[model samples]
Structure formats: structure tokens, C-alpha cells
Target chain A: MKWFEYQMEVDQLHASDALKARLLAMQPDSQTSRDHSAPAQRGRAIRFPHWRRWAAGAAACAAVAVVGSQVLLGMGPAGAGISTMSMTAGGAASSTAAAYDAAAPEAAAYSLAENGLSARSAAGADSAVAGEKIIYTARLTLETKDYDAARAALEQALAAAGGWMENSSESPYDNRRSLSMTLRVPADSYEAFLAAAGETASVVNRSEQADDVTAQYTDVAGRIANLEGQRDRLRELQAGADTLADLLDIEAQLSDVQYQLESWQGQLDWYDDQIASCTVTVDLREVETYTPTGETFLERLGAAFAEGWQNFVLGLAAVAVALAGLWPVVLLVAAAAVAAALVLRRRRRR
Target chain B: MWRVSQEELYRIAVENYSDSVYRAAAHHCTNPIDAEDVVQDVYEKLLRRKGSFSSEEHLKAWLLRVAINRCHDLSRAASQKDVPLEETMPAPPAADHSVLDAVRALPEQYRNAIYLHYFEGYTAAEIGRLLGAPTNTVLSWLHRGRALLHTMLQEEIEDEMV
Candidate 1:
């Protein structure tokens, strides 16, 4: 037979009687009285369709208006700048003088050496490391009455100065509370936020230390460069490997070299991260005690029980609904089985 | 609330297309149970999704796409696990029926195109869209499937007569 004829025959022969019966049983009836009554049980609540449509239309218009305003606002500054520049020469001079006056105090507050560590180091020895450029460390201790408020203010100052906290803790001792945050304030802002933190609390102690690792850095760099050259030679050997055995041998050697290189790179990166950013340790204490608020035991227990019960009921309801949907198929199967058995008994008697 | 009811959709799908999915899967899968599994999975997915299709053609096309994807996914997963095919498959009708077996055993791409063209009345272009392939690729598949089918079927007829 032709392929098409065979395909059609296969389709016909394989048509599932059971599937067809099930599909026939599932066909929806028009104006089905029993199904119509089910929807009526919910109480027919009419909604004005136009109201929702109008609301959606209004929302779209509002969104367009907002976008239009943002575009105009973005263009406003550039437009204003060009118009001001094109104004009378006398007026332009007055505007320039006013702008400079407004910018002066902000510029004065940030010293070039104080705002950038590279700039500070280039000026001469870093102020904090002037005497001992090697083996120098700085320690600061601050005391505040309100630990949280003092910590928040210190954090804000650190963020404004592009600084980071290394370690911080609140210690309880008698009626007085204390906080100590080890902060790595920007070398430029080290003097500024430190002074500000001191104003927030009392400055108990201040110390600075520096350590130079120039020789160590140079030694490690030389070793890494030598190893990288060796590793590159091994890679060339691996690429030119003629036999599988030689390839495997080269791979083993390459693996060892790569491992050592990665270890050296990790150590170098750690050293670089530490050298790039200076570390400052600050110890702070509150002058007053910290007292935490309390909640009743029964209230906490009751809330936990309520949440557990709600979850349990929801899980049970989901399972019940799933089983309910499957019940129709189950019932249909049961009825068919009973009918089949009855027919079989009748045929046997005949 | 909708023009086509879920029950009607379910009925039409099960009656007309269930066996097609089963036969397609049975050719790819080893056993009737797996074939049944594929059909159940396809129908359950259709029921879960609320698709208001424009016509019966759209609905049938959607179902076919889902079935083909499911079968392909199952076949790929089966291959990955290094499953021995026959353990999951029924024995062939006999050596005499080699052609029918071989045609059924042709790879998924060929089987699908041939089946849709001959069984579901799909043209090569229609098959291309359904299979996410070019029309020429689908035509080649159909031609290849026919050649494979003819060889296998002829072998089976000779074996049966002997």
C-alpha cells in the first residue's frame, strides 16, 4: 500500500474506543438546565462594564501625561542654561558671581588631599603615616549616651566620605551602654568623620600606625612572573602533544602549574585589596544603659498557633477541591463497570 | 461564559486526537502505559490552560504542538539516562511485520511530518509552522518518511506471506 493509505489505515485502526466514549460523555449541552442552576446559586451580580473600561482609559491618559511631564522636566535645565548664556553681558556676569558664591563653601569643606587618598599620598607622607610610613596603625575610641543614634550618624558620615566599617559592636556594662565600630574611613575623610564622630560622643583615645610592604610586594611579583613564563611554555608543549600519553603527561604538569598560579593570584589580590583601602578601628560606648521592650508570652504563643492552623486548613482545602474535580470521572467509571457486569450475567443466562 | 465550553473541548480532544497522540508516543515510547501517560499529560495541560481559540483548527494545532514537544522531551530524557529501549517497549508484531515496525521506528522528525500529513490533513507548510521548521525541510521529512515507510512496509508484507 502507499504510505498515505497506510498512514490513514493506522490512524483508523488505532482510534481509541475508550477515549471516544469519554469525549462523547464530556460534550457540553446547550441550555443545560442543571448547569445553569449552579451559576444562579451564586446570586447574579450585574457589573457596569463601561465603568471598568473608562477607568482603564483614564489610567492610560494619566500615564501619558506623567511621561510627557518627565520629558519636559529633563529638557528644562539645558534650555534654561542656553537662554542664560545668551542673555545681556552684564546680567551673565552677575549670574556667574552668584553661582560661584553658592559653590564656594562646599568646595572649601573638601580639601583635595583630604578627599582622595592618592592625592594625600602624593602631597607627601600620608598625614596619618607621616612619621612611621611603615608599621603604623590608627585606633579611635568614642563614647555616646545613645548608642543607636550615634552609630547611625557615624554610618551616614562614613557613607558621605566613601568609607566602610570593618567591625562594630554594642557592649552592655552596668547602666552605661557602649558601641565600637572599626571603620575604614577614606584617608581624606579620616580626619573629618573622626572629628565629627568625636563631637557625637567623647573621644577617649586615638592612635595611628603604618606598615610598608614594598619589598615583599616586589619579591612576590617577580616570583609570579617567572612561574607564568614556565606555565606558558608548558601550554605550548600541551598544544604540540603528538600522542595521547604525552598529552596526559603535559596536562598533569599544566594542572600543577595552574594550581600554584591561582593560589599566588588569590594572595596577590588580597594584598592589593588591603593596600588600596586603609583600615581604621573605632571603639565606641554609650553613656546610658540600653533597655529592650517586652511582649507577653500568651500573645506570641496565640499568634504562632493561629498561623499554623491557617496553613493546615488551606492545605486540606486544596486537596479536597482537587479530589472534587476528579469525582465525575471516578463515578462514570464505576457506573460503566456495574453496567458491564450486569450485561455479562444476562449473556451467560442466554 | 465562553463560546466553547471546557467539557466540549475536552470531549473533542479526547475523541479525535487522543489516539493520534498515543500512536505517535507508542511509536517513540516502548509501551502502552507510556503512551497513556503522554495523552493524560497533554490533556491535563490543555485543561489547566484557559485558551479561547478562534476555531477548532487553532485548538487542534495547539494540542498537536504540546503533544509533539512532550514526546520530544521524553525521548531526550530517555536517551540521556541510557535506557534500554525494549524493556519499556512491547515486542514487535513479528519479523514479517518489519516494514510497519520500521516505519513506526523512523526518527521523531520523519514520523511527525508523515503522521500529520496523512492522519491530520496538514500540508507541508502547516507542518513546518507546527514543527518550527522551514517548509522545504518539512517536505524533505515527508519524502524521507515515505521512502522509509515503503521499504519497511514492503519487507513486512514479504515476511508475512512467507
Candidate 2:
């Protein structure tokens, strides 16, 4: 047969009426519930639905405008700079500013002075979610005068706080030793653990971060529930399956569903483990001097002067070493000068 | 550049491209039921998709690609069972049976080239984009598929079957 005949033959091959009927009955995820409730609407076509989108957009725009205006106006009346905002003690300023708005912006700003400290009040918002799923992690860089004493005290502190070294490595550089460790402690003992670590060795630099995984935990939990329902339904279908082909198909689907169920369950379990314990990576180094926090202005001035004098002495030593390193070149120049002098003297005598 | 709603696009796909997708899948599948499953899966995917197609042609190509990929997955999954093609495949229309059988026998790579070039009327370059193959490769597949189909149908088309 010609290729034209072949095209005609293939064109004649249409999907069965049953399959088309099934396709026609299918609804997308967004419309499934609504279509199922009103079967009469199944045949109707819903276009762009502009009004719905416009309504949602207008609501979002209004929300952003309201929040933006309040924050801007609140800052103007409060007369507090960005630096002061971080040092304020409480959320009183933010809350009142958000609530009262233009009616009494000054009253809202005054709450900042009442709140006391601004240092960590910004991040204190998560204090409300204390019972929620959060993964707390901290990184600490520490220094001590003696390596053996610091290392022993570090282990004692970890034991005191019910923490254990999950991983550790120690190395020596320039005759001084440094140790790095990942420690895991119960979430409840996290603050105590930090304090204990500070007592063991001076914490040079410290940073802590909290990952709020409550939303993800709930989402994965929901997926696991749905997968469990699917697996159970598939099992029911399997028991009732009559034909060999039907049984095989169901078995394949069952395995797939089971695999997905286990995967989601595994994820939820991991979240639980992370929420239960906190991971802190600590770096300990042997230092001759400690950089203490909360120093007086006078002490800082004295330190600055001492550092300058030390730098000057080091600079002179560096120059002297450089001159000594060029001795061979200096000796060659001196020898040339002597030979030239001897030749000049011989010519004068002649 | 004109925008069509997702629901409208979906209805259009069901009406226009369903048979083409079914045919594409049927060529690769061992049975018509499996082909039907692939077609169902292709439409379900279109329904679940979060983004809109650029145009009707884009939508059609997406359907064809998805159907072909699903067919490949089904074949891979059923490789161990090794069902006979003649027993599972439904009988085609009486007139041009030999022609389609010859085309189906050409191999998987040739089917995309042959189907797109012959039936869908896509250019060699368009088929390359659809199949994710180089233009030269698609051209050669079309060339080789045409030659192979002709050879397979030569005796039947020339005298006895004609």
C-alpha cells in the first residue's frame, strides 16, 4: 500500500468509545471536588474566569499596601533608626505600630523605650512557636591558653549538658592545636550546652540559627496519610481482582504506592529526629591571648597602643632580616669597588 | 500570543489530539488496552500540568512526546513478560493494513520521524525538536524508515496484495 493509504488506515484507527467517555469524565485537580458535587456543570466550559483572578489580585495588593504604609508611617513617628530597632527589648513597638497606625504613631513609637532591649527582640517572634517543630543549630569558635586542659573541660561540659560529640577532628599547626567537633544535645538543654561550652573555653565567635520545619512536618504528615489511604484501597482492589492481568496490574500499582508510603514515612521520621536534638559545631583553638567581650573604652585604647608598638618593632625586625638575606649581592658590589680603587692607584703611580 | 484558559485548552486537546496520542502509543504498546492507558495518562497529565502551552501546536507536540515516553516506560516494565505482538494488537482497518504494519516494523526511532513527517506533516527540524534528536539524525531516520517501509511493502504493494 502507498504511504497515503497508510495515513488513511492510521487515521481510521480511533480510540474506543469507552476510553473517550472516561476521558470526558475526568476533571483536573483544581475542579475535581466542585465538578463531582454538580454533575450538571460537567459539560460546561469555564474560561479564564477573570473576575476571580481580579478579586484575588486586588486583595493581595490591598494587603501589601496596608502593611507597607503602616511600617513606613510607624518608623517616621517613632524616630528610631534601624540600629535602635535591633536593640529594642520587646515587640511592643512593632505590634502597637501595626495595630494603631496613623491615629497614634507617637504612642506606638514610645513603646520601643518601654520595651528596654532591642538586641534580640526581633528574632523573639519565634518564641511563640517554642512548642513547634524547629531544628536549632549553633556554630561556636573558641580559644583557650592550654590545649589539654581545654579539651578535657570541653568533654566535661558536654557530659554536664547531656551532649555527645557526633564527630570530631583535631590538628596541630605552628605548635598550637585546634579541635573541631559536631555535638548533638537535646533541644531542651541547648542553652545550657552553650553556657557550658563558654565556661570550658572562651567563645570567640558564636552564631545560632533556627529552621522552622513545622509547616513541612505537617505537609509530609498529610502526604503520608494520603499514601496510606491509597495503599489500603489498592489492597482492597487486589483482593477482589479476578483476572490474571488485573491482578498483575494491581500488584504493580500496590508496590509503587507502598514505596511512596515508605518514602514519606521516612521523611517524617527524619524531621522528628532533627526536632528532638540540636546540632552544634564547635571550633577550639589554642591562643596565647583572649579577645574578651564587653571591654571598657580605656582598655581598648591601651590595647590599640600596645598593638601599634608591637607592629613597629615587628616592622624593624622584618627590614633587618631582608638586609641580611642580600649579603651575597652586597659582597659582590664591595669586591668590585675595591678592584676599581686598586686599578686607579696603579695608573696614578705610573 | 492569545491566551486560552486551561479548561478550554484541555477540551481542545481531548477533541483534536486524543486519537493521535492514542495512535502514537498504540504503535509502541503490546496491546490496545495498554495504549488506552497511556492515552488516559497523557490527558491526566495535561489536566495536572501547572503551566499553559504557548499554542495549540505546542500542546499537540507535548501530548505526542508524553505519549511516546509513557509507551517506552510500559515497554520497559513489560520486557520480561515478552507478550507476542500479533496476539495482543487489535486488527487494523482492512484497506491499508500492510502499509501501517510495515511502518510499525521500522523501529522506535523511525516511528517518531515517520509519524511526524508523514501523518502530522511536521518538518525534519520540527521532528528533531519534538524527539530531542539532531536534525541530521531525524532526517536519516525518515530516509531509512521510508526505505525500510517501501522494502517491507514492496512485494505486497506491487502485485499480490494490490
Candidate 3:
């Protein structure tokens, strides 16, 4: 009755000895096809081949996923680049690898370079955008020497542009704090606000986009009008109902119409809000010095030397902190060594 | 896999670790023939694998993991196939087979944990690593599996007495 006896029953179960001989005798050259056994004809062999195929298919899918992600990060611009590049940017900047914000001339120049156009010629594409109902979005990456001054100036500029902070996050990088924030500014002042942000600090990168939503806005507005008409008709019908059942049925239909009307109204309101204001996301980095937009050979050399010096100082500090944390272990090892030496001295004297 | 040659693979798998792999598979696969087939597949994978194992224990663990995965696949396939209730109904166990039937009839999740813990002497921590679950979760699985096994064995003994 002992449950441990179950182990003996399990012990009696094992792979047949012939299976080992067969496995050892398998030719490596012949294993690639894995069709050694007619898998369909076997009593027990059929189950595992299904999983073998599944595992192989899974591995192939993993490889595809890896390559697909690399393509995304390599060629694709930042999220809104589809609309920006498609309409305002001549749709020829697909080869541009820089996907950051476009506040700096270098970013526009970067795209301009990829477009193989003359400097500042990309501006023609931006100026060609004439859509009345468009959602404007601007992303800026700035480097600042003084966070408090930069922040105060940012606040003053936001107030001037009639903008409000929507979402903001601040985190420290190597003892220096960096702030990322999303702001909503009136579309009229989006260009002025970005220019003001550039003056706050050294602009590292910038990108601008105009998403034309006129057709979508008109379609939603039309739907809202239809829903409102239906709701109004339903309300008028409720008053003219002839029987209790008709009255109740009309009431249900009226409520359903009211729900659809509100839903459509919400969509129309969202479109209106998007057209009225621009979403400006800014990344403000606090740096000891600005990175030289190295258009010259001397500037590039100076930046590389400065970076090397900074890295060497940081490495020394890291080693000092690491040794400081190992004091207890060092003490223990020292104590053991002293004790062992005393024992050896006593044995040698004896 | 090439680290161990053809003769070495046969010796290590058939003599050293095939029983372990077979036993791990058997905890889930009630059919002995299917369990043996899983063993052969596990060794076949080892032979074809290009990666070198770090140690003998690594080789054994690899075999066990492959065996368990194959058993999972086989069990899933088995579950989806239709079987009449009459065929699935457990026959009265022979006086000696009450233990095996009781063990075999355990719910699938508990079967591997119970067999590895009770028969193979794997602690909850070792079972946790083998099954890729947290140690605390493996402890609970062992606890529940043990309780289920005790109840089934008790019922079988009572029936035998009658």
C-alpha cells in the first residue's frame, strides 16, 4: 500500500534497448529531412512529428520577427513621419535614419540631405501644406545649461502661446536631470512656440508634421448631423405615439438615437480640438556642454576629445566606488591569511 | 551533441538517462509505447543538436526538458481526439496495479510534479527550475498532487477490501 512503490512501477517503464541502437546508428546526413520513419504509419511515432514541425515553424517565425523589427528601427522614421514625409516632406526622406524631433536646422538639413536637395529647399514642401483642417505636431530635443532658467522661459512661452502641459516626466541621467513633456498649444502659435523653445537651449533635433484630417472631419461632422436629426425625429415621434406599446417602443428608439448622437458628437469634438491645437512633445536634456553639430573637421575632433576625457574620468569614479563596497570581504580574507601564517610559524618553530 | 560521439550518445542515453526521460514522460503519457517514442525523439534531438552542453547534468536536464515538452504536445493532441466514455472508464486495477492506475489517473499538472518529487527525489526548488516555475508555486503543486494521490490510493484500497 506504500505510495513509494509507484517508483518501482515507473522504473519498470523505459525506452526499449533497440531505440538507443537505432538513434546511435542514425546518419547525420540523413537527419535534415526527418522522414526516416513514415510518421503516419506508426502506432507511437505520429505524435512527436507534429511537435517537431511546430517547433521548426516557430523558429522560422522568430527569425522573421527579428528581421522585421530591425527593418522598422533602421528605415522607418519616427511615428508621425508617414504623414510628414508623405505630404509636407516630398515623401523622399525615407532613407533618413534620424528619427528624433526636428527643432534644429540639422534635422531638416538631415532630411534635406537625404532628399538630395539644396539646403533649406525642404522648406518649400512645408510651405506647400495648405490644408485648413490639419493636426499639427512638433517634437523638439533641446540641451540646456541652466534647467531653472530654461524651465521658466518654457513656462512663459507656453503661457504666451495659450498652451497647457498635458503630460510631463523628469528622470535623472548620470546625476543630470532630463525632462520630457507633451504640451498642447494653439495651432496658430505652433511655429512661434517651437522657435521660442529653440532659444531656451541648444536645439539637438526637431521634427514637424501636418496631418490633414479634413475629409475625416467632414465625414464625422456629417454623421453627427444625421444622428442629431434622427434623435430629434425620435423625440417628435414620441409625442405622437398612439398606444402604450408604441409610446414605450418610441421611448426605447429615442434613447438609442440619443446614445448614437452623443457618440458622434464626441468624435466631432475630438476632431475640432485636434485641428484647434498642436501637440508639442519636447525632450529637454541638461548637459554640461552642447554637442557640436560638427559641420567642420576641427569641431568633430574637439567633440571626440571632450567625449574621451569625460569617459576616462567616469571610469575612474566607477572603480573607486566598486572597491569601497568590497571592504567587508577584503577584511575577512586578510584575517584568514594572518591566521594561516601564524599557524605555519608555530609549526615551523616546533 | 557532437561533444558525445555515436557510441557515447548510445551509452549515455540508453544506460544513464533514458530511464529518467522515460519516467518524466510516463508521468503524463499513460501509454508506455508513446512514452518510449518520446524517448527516441529526445535522443534524436540530442544527436542532431549542434550546441555543446556544459556538463553531464546539463545534458540530462536537456533530455528531460525535451521529453516533458514532447509529452505536453502528445497530451494536447490526445485530449483533442474524441474517445467514448466506455473506453475512458478506468477498469478495476489488478491487486498489484492499484498504485500505477492511481498515479496515472492524476490530473496532468500534478502528475509530473508528484512523480518527480516522490519517485525521483527532486526537491521543490529543483522541480521549480526543471518546470520553469517559481519554487513556491512548485511547492503548492506538490502539496496538491500529494493530496490527490493520497485520496485516489485510499479509494482504490477501500474498493479492493470490498
Better of 1 and 3 by lDDT: 3
lDDT of 1 by residue, A1-350 (tens): 44444555465545356744543443233211221111212221212236678999999999888656544543343344334333433443333233223223222222222223222233332222222122223566665667778778877878877888787777776445666667776555555665676666555445444444433454566667767998999999999989999999999988998888888878767656665566777777664211111135454334334434444455577788787889998789999999999999999656
How far does residue A198 in candidate 2 sit from its true spot (Å)?
A: 1.2
Which ranges in model 2 have alpha carbons more than 4 Å from their true place? A1-131, A306-350, B1-162
lDDT of each: 0.59, 0.69, 0.67
Tens-digit lDDT string for candidate 2 (A1-350): 55677678789878887888788789887333321121222221212236788999999999888656554543342333222333331342344333233323243233334333132232234233333455667777787888788889888878877878899999997546899999988877877787788787776666565555555666787888888899899899999999999999999999999899899999989988887888989999986544433246555444444434444455577788887899898889999999999999999656
Docking class of 3: incorrect
Give every collision pair in model 2.
Answer: A86-A118, A87-A117, A87-A118, A87-A119, A88-A117, A88-A118, A89-A117, A89-A118
Q: Write one digit per residue (lDDT tens) for candidate 3, span A1-350.
A: 66546767777877677865665566555553442332222223212225678899999999888655543442232223323433433331243233233534455555445544444443334332233355667777787879879988988999999999999999986656899999999977877888898799877666676554545666676777777888788888888889999999988888888888788889878978987888999989886655555555576445544544444466677887787889898889999999999999999656
lDDT, candidate 3, at A145: 77
TM-scores for chain B, in order?
0.79, 0.83, 0.78
In angstroms, the error of model 2 at A206 is 2.1
The candidates, ranked best first by TM-score, are 3, 2, 1
Calculate each model's fnat, 2 decimals: 0.13, 0.45, 0.34
